[model samples]
Target: MVLGTSFHFDGQGTATAADAMKRYCGLLGEQEMEGKSSPQWLATKELVKDDGEMVFEEGISRFCPNCAKILKSAVEGTYPRLI
Candidate 1:
């Protein structure tokens, strides 16, 4: 099951689901592109779960301080054991 808050459009025009996912996934596809920049958190490798999952910990980066705080709370709430 996926748990997420609403994706922020930052006042950009709304997109169809297909268009949104296409753009989102494209940002995660590869680093060092010509004109697009992915959020650092999206591009980082992460452990999938707490059950002996793969471990990858690059420093956590967020779009902003508020987002980092919110993410911390959500992650701690949902995966208490993983923290």
Candidate 2:
């Protein structure tokens, strides 16, 4: 499992967050496949206010072909997007 360093963001980090999560999912998915397991990934981000109180928390996961297609479609534009 890979642990990401803490990053602080406010109103202007949507792209940064998306990039980070994308990279994390890619790496984790590759690792899972390498280990002969069903490719999968789990990601969590904690959002807090300046006072450090938890404002929001989210967890995301992807498995196998779904994960593979999502990333691939972004780059290759081959797969139809899910609605």
Candidate 3:
């Protein structure tokens, strides 16, 4: 399977899901939270429990820091024995 920084984006260098979220968040304005977790974290949890890889494939080939963090959590969560 493909690996590393190269898998981070498409030929046009766009991360559709993350980009869309950026725009969407911009329109929505800043959300002030003292300690609330990000929406991405919530979604990542669900994804890891479900079909996280497929979701990951559709977006950037590269894992953003958040994605990478959540993915590592998911992988470890899914396969404790391996860890």
Candidate 4:
């Protein structure tokens, strides 16, 4: 299990708070898999630089809608989500 920090978004736009949260989580997952750096990772890199230390959990476990194809090919298990 990939353990990582979870993010929260303020409900201020047309999208629901949950939607925003999922979007960001997906972005983070993509960055991790690609070995690419993201704003979130960059900001926290010094504080917590080890990628192995982060584990995807709960909402973070789901694949990004945009990157679903790649994830489907590589990852196991059915993607779980909150209704």
Q: How does model 3 score by TM-score?
A: 0.28
Tens digit of lDDT per residue, candidate 2, span 1-83?
22233434444453333345454445534534323322221211221233111111121232223454433333343533222
Q: lDDT values of the candidates?
A: 0.31, 0.33, 0.36, 0.37
lDDT of 4 by residue, 1-83 (tens): 32233323335443433454456555654544224344334233311323312322222344344443323433332333212
Error of 1 at 2 (Å): 12
Model 2 poorest 10 in a row by lDDT: 51-60
Clashing pairs in 3: 7-61, 7-62, 8-61, 8-62
lDDT of 3 by residue, 1-83 (tens): 22212322223453445553333233222232123233333244334433335544443234343344444444445422220
Worst lDDT run of 10 residues, candidate 1, spans 51-60
**Preferred candidate (TM-score higher): 2 or 4:** 4
For model 1, residues 1-83, the per-residue Cα lDDT tens digits are: 11121222335764433343444444444433333223333322222333101111111231123234323433444422221
Scored by lDDT, the top model is 4
| Residue 7 shift from truth in candidate 1, angstroms | 6.6
Q: What shift in Å separates residue 6 of candidate 3 from its native position after superposition? A: 24
Q: Kindly report which residue pairs in candidate 2 clash with one another.
A: none
Candidate 3 at 62: error in angstroms?
3.6
